[model samples]
Target: MRRIYHRFPQQIDLDFELARPFRDVLSCIARLHNTHTTSKGSGGLVKERMIIQVADGRTQFLDLDDLIPLSEKTSEAVDFRVDFQRTLLTPEKRLPVAENVFYLRIVDKGPVTECYAAKESPHGDMDAMDLRTFLKGACE
Candidate 1:
């Protein structure tokens, strides 16, 4: 089975850079859970884990334990992308909002060189420069 390293909540945006190599592929697991309560059960829950190739600019979704080999001789930086879907549950008569809970996790990597979780805002700017700046000053 694949291992999870990082997790993020639903509807929240996340940005990070991978600058290291591991024995296997880098990945992220996204989980979604509905908060609505029904007489039948609690709510709906869904999970999607994608094996990501950090060096590639496009998004590549993979199955569980799927391995994407990395060239040890090559030196390149990797970027991560996580896309979430909207929910279909709503209270009484309010509009249905995409408010599911989610999380992100990386497989087997020992330690991440850098990771950043963008602030949750209705109009927050999650830009590349802002992420770089946040990572730069995170530990300081």
Candidate 2:
């Protein structure tokens, strides 16, 4: 297979200062069109939200959440949340990949690497990271 050389940047740096303003904007967007159904006693209200289901073929999503200011992520910010379930899960029952706690989404033709040294093996650091739910306690 042709290689994706690490001539470009491998990691992205996020400024902690830029988070609050972005959070305000995401909050406004989440409250726009979603209809509030009913209150869940103490859990607040449950509303059908607009979620952005991103198909991560290139595996750039390893940093997509960090690209946004995800410090105060909630179901209310579903519009800005990104779901990376590429292989998808059956509604019948929650499934596990390879019977492991970590869901193996893909073999990762091009995986995450800190640097491309002379002897840097592509598979040295396993690309299989624990699935992080975009929304808190709302991952299905």
Provide the overall lDDT of each model, using Cα atoms, as 2-decimal numbers. 0.32, 0.24
lDDT of 2 by residue, 65-124 (tens): 332333243212121122222221344543322111121111112222121112112222
Question: What are the RMSDs of all candidates, in order?
Answer: 11.1, 17.0
* Over 4 Å off, model 2: 1-20, 36-71, 74-140
TM-score of 1: 0.28
lDDT (10s digit) by residue, model 1, range 31-75:
111112332223543222222223132334233223333323222
Q: Model 1, stretches more than 4 Å misplaced? A: 1-67, 70-76, 89-96, 99-112, 119-140
Positional deviation of 41 in candidate 2, in angstroms? 37
What's the distance in Å from true for residue 67, model 1? 9.6
The residue pairs in collision within model 1 are: 5-105, 5-106, 6-104, 6-105, 7-104, 8-102, 8-103, 8-104, 10-102, 54-78
